[model samples]
Target: MLYVFLSICCSVIVSVLLKLAKRYQIDVFQAITWNYSMAILLTWFFFKPTIPSLQNAPIHIYLGLGVLLPLLFMVMATSVRVAGIVRTDVAQRLSLFIPLLASFLIFGDSLNKLKVIGLIIGFAAILCSIPWQKKTANRKVYSNAWIFLLIVFFGIGIIDILFKQVALFKEVPYTTSLFLIYILAFVIALIVLIFRVATKKTKFSWPHIMFGWILGVANFGNILFYLKAHTSLSKSPSTVFSAMNIGVIALGTLVGLVVFNERLSILNKVGVALAVIAIVVITIS
Candidate 1:
């Protein structure tokens, strides 16, 4: 439980940092590049992963995670920029519902009445939380917001499911998996960076680089604790995922109100209430 709570807190801090990045004039791409680089270094220093023999592990695991990691970071950063932190977090976290449904259908995971109810309520809560306003002007800004949220949903949902699959390798130390995953992600990002440089579009900024490091550290901490908690708890990973999400939403909302001075419309208020109810149903289920 302590690990779970700490992980959620780390998530909130990540959101807060991203929100602050706008004010600090941090470029999203550069920030993420540096973030991953720093995370790789930090993980190396602390975890000291033992190299896994390729002969033993499935080759696809490495290949798939290599592709997924960079895309996940890019989409998540874009989602934060398009939607506010609160909405981005909600969209990404709510994706667990998709995986829960998938698990039941594909893996024959059982869903009791309470679990089903909780899933339904949680889904409804996410829908309610989406701010749908009739456009008063010609601005199409919010259009991208919806698309970004969808991307976040799909990316995070797939990632969560993938993590569960990876977790099945009980012999693979968590630290080793973490190191290999991030190392692959960094190498991929570096390759892309080289391409960007070759195209003469590589402009580096210190702010982006520094913030990226901060983001990397925070993200590493978040995943480390969450993974540990998932390992320790008897609850299903999906359930733990859902509970941690509720914590992020609650914390994000409080920070949004206090720090960003973001106000909720009546609809938003109702949406929040529904979200809370959904969380309750999911929790006690």
Candidate 2:
């Protein structure tokens, strides 16, 4: 239970850190690169993972996650740019429903009535979080942002499914798999950086580099504790997922209101309220 709560706190910090990075004028790519680099180092120190035998391991499983990792970062960064922080985060998190549904259909995972209700309420909250354009005079800008949001939803939804698939692989130790995934992801990002260099588009700033590393370490900690909690608890993954998701949003909202003096419009406030209600229902059920 403590691990679960800590995961939520870590996640909230990630969002806040991203916002801070932006305030410091950190380029998104640089921020992410530094973040992942730091995360890789932190994960190494904390897990002290040994390389598992490649023999008898399904190579394709690792390969798939390796590919997914960099793509997830790209899409998530773009999503944050296209959508505001809060809305983008909400969409990305709630998009886990895609994988949840896939687990039911493909894996034949059971979903009880309570889980169903939770799913409904969770999605309802997501819908409410969507930023509605109110007679905006600029049609082109609105259209572009809306299209980006859709792309974000699709990208994040696919990423969630990929994570679930990786989690379901019982043959490999989850920790080992995660370690390898990060290492491979770092290599991929390096390759991408080379391309950026060739194109003369890469920009380096100390703030971005430093903050990225901090963000990465925090992210690694967040996932480590989350996986540990899941291993320790007997609760359903869906329930755990709901708790983490709602908790991050609730925490993010509070931080935005208190630290940033950001005000939620009526619709967003309602959405947050609905999300809280859904969390309660999911936890009790």
Which one is best on TM-score? 2
Q: Choose the strongest candidate by lDDT.
A: 1
Identify the runs in model 1 with alpha carbons over 4 angstroms from their true place: 75-94, 106-108, 134-138, 141-152, 273-285
What TM-score does each of the candidates earn?
A: 0.82, 0.83
Could you tell me the TM-score of candidate 2? 0.83
Residue pairs with colliding backbones in model 2 are 34-212, 35-212
Model 2 lDDT tens row, 1-285? 577779888988887887887787777666766666777777678777777787866567667767766766776666555555545655676666665666566655567888689768877776665555433343233335656566666766665555555566667776777788777777887788668868989766687688778888778878766766555543356665666766676667768889999777787677788778877787677
Count clashes in each candidate, considering only residues at least 3 apart in sequence or on different chains.
1, 2
Error of 2 at 271 (Å): 2.4
117 in model 2: Cα distance from truth in Å? 2.6
